[model samples]
Target: MRRLALVAALALSANAYPAQAQAVAETADPYIWLEDIYSPRAMAWVEAENARSLAVLKADPQFAGFYADALKIAEATDRIAMPRQIGGQIANLWQDGTHVHGLWRITSPAEYEKAEPAWQTLLDLDALSAAEKANWVWAGADCEPTAERRCLVALSDGGEDANIQREFDLATRSFVSGGFTLPKSKQWVSWETPDSLIAARDWGAGTMTASGYPFVVKRVKRGAPLEAASEVFRGKPDDVFVIPRTFTDGAGHSEVVIMRGITFFEAEFVRVTPQGTTPIAVPRKSTVTGLTQGRLIFQVNEDWTPAGGQPISAGSLVAVDPAGKAAPEVIFAPGPRQSVDADEVAVTQGHVLAAVYDNVRGRAMRFTRTASGWQQSVLPLPDNAAISMVSSDRASNTAYVSVQSYLLPTALWKVDAAAGTAIQIKQTPARFAADGLVTEQFMATSKDGTKVPYFITHRADMPLTGTTPTLMTAYGGFQISYTPAYSGVTGKLWLERGGAYVVANIRGGGEFGPAWHEAGLKTKRQVIYDDFAAVAEDLMARKITSPQKLGIYGGSNGGLLMGVELIQRPELFGAVSIQIPLLDMLRYEKLSAGASWVGEYGTMANPDEKAFWLKTSPYSNLKPGAPYPETLIWTTTKDDRVGPVQARKFAARMKEYGLPYLYYESTAGGHGAGANLKEKAMTIALEMVYFQRRLMDTK
Candidate 1:
């Protein structure tokens, strides 16, 4: 047997604290070697861990059956082809057993409305990967404004965040030889002129932030070398990232803006013109959505007390004049209980469409600019459904919107923004039987007398015996609302097996708008954890489930939440699944893309913040004698967004302390667990098998 702490070494960094206290608080983690992602020694350790975990989990009698079910569901041909209207054509990215990597295809709107649309493939990723002997995943494409024929296509290797950009011709349906090509890097590129593009990438050392992101923006001419690109703007090394923004309106008016991201939630927008660059009057914590009728529009993430203007509340959608450089005009103000969950501002030939959420429920509105001000007309949509404006073009008045609920598969609606008319265009076939399943919402009281809402999905006839196998999850950060979402995988794999699913809408989410998230910011984040614990306890109190049969899961920020719960309330859950999470919060500032999130999570530079971190950092808190539930922790080698190093260190620390944990790290797949559908299915199957063993078989 391998001695868990044999390779461990601890290091202490004094950050404005007594040397003794700092020494006691910090340890040179032996697992720091794991941070060298592709190092042979680290990779060998990862391979051994993967094999050991797979041997046990895959040996289960239900493994093959679960894999088959998951693969079939994932490759189902009847699944909806989510469409986007571009250049008067309906385009979609599709994948199946035959097209594993996916096919970027297009069709006419008329044919797309048919039962089975005739799709013409524009790019076949699997074929390209096979030809190049490389794993290629589609990042996205930015087509030229007027013709929409030439596009800058971004492709990532193994689904990593770093991508290579190339110019492609839509007419020829092939990459444009001798056209624009940007070498592989984590970069942002926007269309400038027919022969120039505004870009920001690693221009060697000192060109990137501490988080490994580009901090310098430049103009790259058609055939010039990256070094030859003219400098457009440059941000400090401590700045999060810097990039150029190009806003083109329905009226064919175009504006270039320089965005210097001072932090994750703050930025400075300078409107670029032929004469020079002019600073726009906008709050630090605001995001520019698009330009409508030659006016710049943005959503405020923080309350704006403009130099000479009255206070504008956070979460308000405001518009400003780039020409006049005047005070922003509040286009739409969210109510005390409302937020723009899916902030959709699509400028059509004549009008703008906005989708707003009130208490986690969705609604769409039409905003028409008048001489007096902006007027709103709420579009007709079903209550309690999540609405998303998937596709719209400046040339057309019709926009594609999708509405879905927990039980209802997505239904595509073609909305005429000018007329405010929404007509159902298409829908997805039911992937699982929903006849007996029912969904209902409930509220649990938090520690601070706050009401936290949650949804329960299970059989209507479920007995309240406190023995039901339950899977509970939530993502309570980033102000992202947890609205009703349809998941056929859960329906078929868990619910059909007599399991229950619960989603908590707790603090630190946009469920109740900005106020909800503000309640749990930084050091005050304990309330967010308390809200989740409250919901779990509420379920137990209602006799819906007991600790023996309950499992919790989450990914990314939610993965952090799962790690916290595993340490704080181990007795409340039978199993915990943490995926692509930030576990070692202390050294997170030094990891890939971690510095950008300091605005959300307080930094350790402050003595008080360091104290909070010393107490809460999951990896550091793993004591040798504490009892921890058997946990499933997984991440991807290509996950540059959050870095798999944190997960690796956590698992290694758990091993050092002899805690029970199953770790799996894929060689590829970026921020997402997998680059292809098969990989996703395999991971899902493994998770299901683990949950079944802990929550169902044991029960």
Candidate 2:
């Protein structure tokens, strides 16, 4: 989510006349000048202006009574917890032209009753001026567990003036306040243990700095600082497992191991007992991954061939005992001419079940081991549908997999290992009527002749006239497959609004596993962009949509996609929505939380990598006199993943170049725009309105 203040400014500038552009441009930073003129900011300003216009409309006698009655109805129906009002909170207020402080709250039935008298007394003070009355707005409740039930409240005013501190006297009992400064820059901060807080801070230059897994515990009277009871290992910590007392080796040594991935071949396991930390070596020269109780599983590649200097092969699963005394045992072996990578493995009483994925076959296979040997079984697959195994419940011997296809919506299934059958348990429901919805599988040839798979969805009955409004979205990096799934708000707002939605399965994604992803990464980065462009061109050639009626959207790495496309083919899209994008490639390695992406996007530390990155980075490609699409760049200040400064500086430069775009920044809400469901819905709604209004208006 973009910042509200920037949204207000952009909303007004979006529709500003050419004469006003100069004035607005002068006041805003050059980096985002173009966005300031026609982005979400401009739209938001229009809403504000309309609110004022409605106030004038209320002055008329016919409208005055209607407005009053509407207010009464709104207030009467403003009960909490209803679908329409959940997570709703009073954001701001003004009185006598002077802003006043406000706080939000949601109280339990018991707490509400206790505060009822005080609230009524405050309301009964009708003798006070209207400014005082207007100063208050209910924010909402904090539903987190607490010893005493309490109402959630926020301090919205009293920055320097006003006696509003007294106003919170009744609410102070529920307040739990403490602050911890982060040791490094991170995209997110969260609490894992009941009394422990963990933050993932990004400090540019491929280095990640961490704090607070070892910090003081707050709000707990008896809790000790996490560092006191914690032990830091030499290598990066990947996972933690607790061994039972019964399994002790009787050397007064109970194994607690930390697995560190140094490379695909080498993973170091450091074991700690009552004595001290000891290094335990298992199989190297292979991909030793996955975890189960009392064992570190290794999957060795049958044929070692270096692709991009990374080992690639098919392998088996092997396990070593905690004592580190004997040769590892082969628990399961891959089928001949077929490689298996253990997606998940779980141990039961004297039995082990493993979920494996066959890259060569593009399907899932399962194996179970008894006292005798291993028994393998092939799981049933839905017609034309692919399965990606997520996890297995060893206790029940059941596995969970996500099934998807070009024509079918994504469904989650629980596979019964014993029966070798899959049971469809849940699926995303189509929010809008699917009677007219159609999805088609299409292929696009990249610049290098790489065949890219893509899916297109639109109104089934629409003509192939090349004039329909279309929105194409793609994320072709990080080996993350873009599965076909149902989105309620997106369906209602975009598809139902007569817009076509296309998802491009470009390289750099795990659609076909690691090889597919590696094809579009680092020096091959341009392949992903070429693939995305090919998809866009294919849609136009098929007469499904034209450049004038096409819109594009993507976030994070995908944001990089939008940025590149807007610069490379500005005429290809009518409107572009780039959320939390990484645009500044030159300085990206310098920003907080930027280094983590170096694996997917190579570090610019090397001149060659730097040159390639600069060639494709949208920020570096922005020209002074080139025409660009009307772009909306959204980001958040609390985004620990990708710093908002990238969007800020990009918008500033675009504005400097006199490009038309908008930059909206959310002051709160981490990497995402909203903190709750309603906020998320509102953000989506705003994007739909912007895209629909712009794309549908093309001639």
Candidate 3:
């Protein structure tokens, strides 16, 4: 019945849009019923749609092979056990053939460094899920500070962002009876101590914000009911979210902080003490990276002028003794084309390791406190690669850094902060034959004359032709940097099968820090779309790939990019893969978590922003008879981030207007589209198959 309903809706929607691109009317929409997520009727429609999509895609000749190889790659036992330091022991969450849902296990550092570590499982998600008949997904644990053993374990059902946190003992390796337990809701929690906690979650009624996140924080003591917990801090319902975060420095100094996320990139940090909440006098664009030596260390993303001191640069790392009366001191500052990597800071005992990028190349520095003041020295590391901090702790000067490039498999390095020395710990075994793969950087001139950098990975001997089947992707939003990293699945499934890949580092990202992102924010967002289209056009101009063989893919914000480009520049692409996207820009604010992103994407309530969205919104501008590539639109029913409704509405609208599009939605996996390894592998296979059919295989 649901399938027939969709078919009927498609027939009506085939001509849903106006002849000219114009502001869409709410009255024209015919598939708002699909927005009822998880209702039996809506789910029935989803199941029928999934069945139809599976029947078609699974019958493709490449489907079986892609699935087999992806499953093998996912289930491979030899993959590195990325170690997480906990309680002076190495912990890891692993999933393979033996353990499908994954096993949170622990081992010693010495044992972990060995080829095959004897791992002791602390929690088996698969077994627990089976026993309870619930789809239990591990969200991670926040442990006690002193012992770092007793923890508050977070578990989500069906992979929702909202989850239930329960306390567990690491010594006994079991959930303690009558332990600290918070009922399921989107929350922020931290251990005030073993006997008490600081948290913000849905208490009863009107506790969550308009965006479905907690706005009030409370102190819940052991053995006390949630309602009896005293309110510590409260935020307005319109704010993004309020979080209670506990930061512990190397010298046994700890600070309880309340982070009020006013916008996506803007936040306010306040110190919570016995007296009350005191606001920290830092720029709203600054982040408290880590604490060290009783000094609050953070990276400033906006030009900040203290009460009386001169201004600090936008991309400078600064340290301040918040408890003292000393002025803020800039620790490190990057020059013209340099920016600190967003996720590259790690705090070790008495030291902070930072990775900075210049012209898309990586460099590291170690900052240590001295008698006079804090000082920094360069740490030896390879350039022209993406480097990340895998694991680090405040207990010791031991940290792990993983480095990789487009062609290079990731290699882990253990860095000693005291000596500023690093040693190779492990290198991933190459999953595919890469005798002569070339990685080259190129720049495309955007419409606004901004130079956008991109990476191309292809066979070294391949000719400069306009017919290579190239898959291009980009994500240009939210100050997130897109760096070079090795992907086993991409190599084994796509590259080995004679496909070239390109990654475009456009504006609205932290590629060159705050300034680069600022240029593409809100009202100036068209430059980001223009940057992506310019890269695609540049690829064709360089004879790398032409429209006949070019495919593009992106998820989340990237998916929105795909949508905009699909409508605005349809002739440039042969295939489009949009996963978990936002399409209905006019009504986006009312969608799940849409109101929270108003800073990144301007609210439609404003006249100028509404006009801008009306002119360029993919959903609003999708008119009938427009030339568009055969597109694949996939999402998950459990996705609470962008939600699955957007995808459903877009597909239904496309069908209404008789456009070429494919739609599929998984029942679980939340925002990512899968819960277990097999589920993820299948989605990958399906996506690759779609690309192969459009760009590689002769139809």
Best candidate, lDDT: 3
Query: Whole-model lDDT for model 3 versus the true structure?
Result: 0.85
Best candidate according to TM-score: 3
Task: Give one digit per residue, the lDDT tens place, for model 3 in 1-699.
Answer: 012233233321212333444635445667778888978888888888788788888889889999999999889888888878888999999999888878999999888888889999899999999998999988988888877989999999888898999998989999989889999999989988778899999987888888888989999999988879999999888889898888787789888888898987788888888898888888998887778877778888999998888789998888877664778877788887999964688889889888888888787789877777668887777778998988888898998888898888888888899999998878888877777788899999999798999999998877778878999999899888888988888998888877899999999888898999899888788899899989998999999887768899999998998988887777778899998998888888888889889989999889888767776777777767565777899999888878999888888788878888888998889888598889999999999999998888853
- List the lowest-lDDT window of 10 residues for candidate 1: 7-16
- Which candidate, 1 or 2, has the higher TM-score? 1
Give me candidate 3's TM-score against the actual structure: 0.96
Model 3 clash pairs are: 13-656, 13-657, 14-656, 14-657, 14-658
Clashes of 1: 6
Clashing pairs in 1: 9-28, 9-30, 10-27, 10-28, 11-27, 11-28
1-699 per-residue lDDT for model 1 (tens digits): 122133112212112223433453476667889999999999999999999999988999988988888989889898778887778998898999999889999999999989889999899989999999989998988887767888898999999899999998878989998899999999999887778888889888899998788988888998888779988888899999987878788788888888899988789988878776788878887888888778888888788877788888998888788876566778888988788853566768777787787767778888887879889998887767888878887888888888888899888888898888988878887767888999988899998899888999999999999999999999999888888888888888899999999999988888877778878878888788889989999999999998878899999889989987776666678889999999888888888889898887889897777786776667766666455678999999999899899999999978887989999888889997699888988889899999999899973
Q: Write the per-residue lDDT of candidate 2 for residues 1-699, one digit (tens) a residue.
A: 223243333331111133322333335334432233236764464345334433433343433333333233223222121111111211111111111122232332223223121121212111232545532222222221111122223221101111121111123432334322232221222222223322222223332232111111112111443233343333342211111111211122223444444432244555545565576555443444433445555655343432223332445566655566654556665554233434444433223444443322245555554556456666676643455555443234455666665435556665666666777655644445567888777887877887777777788898899989998898988756675655544555567767788888888765654567667767778778888888988898899987778889998889888888876666567789998888877666556545546657776777777767555667766666565666787765545557576777677677778977765655444456543333344345456655755687446
Candidates 1 and 3 compared: the better one by TM-score is 3
The RMSD (Cα, Å) of candidate 3 is 4.4
Q: How much is the lDDT of residue 348 in candidate 1? A: 80
Q: Candidate 3: where are CA atoms >4 Å away?
A: 1-19, 26-28
- When summed lDDT is taken over every stretch of 10 residues in candidate 3, the lowest stretch is 6-15
Counting clashing residue pairs in each candidate, in order, gives 6, 39, 5
lDDT of each: 0.84, 0.51, 0.85
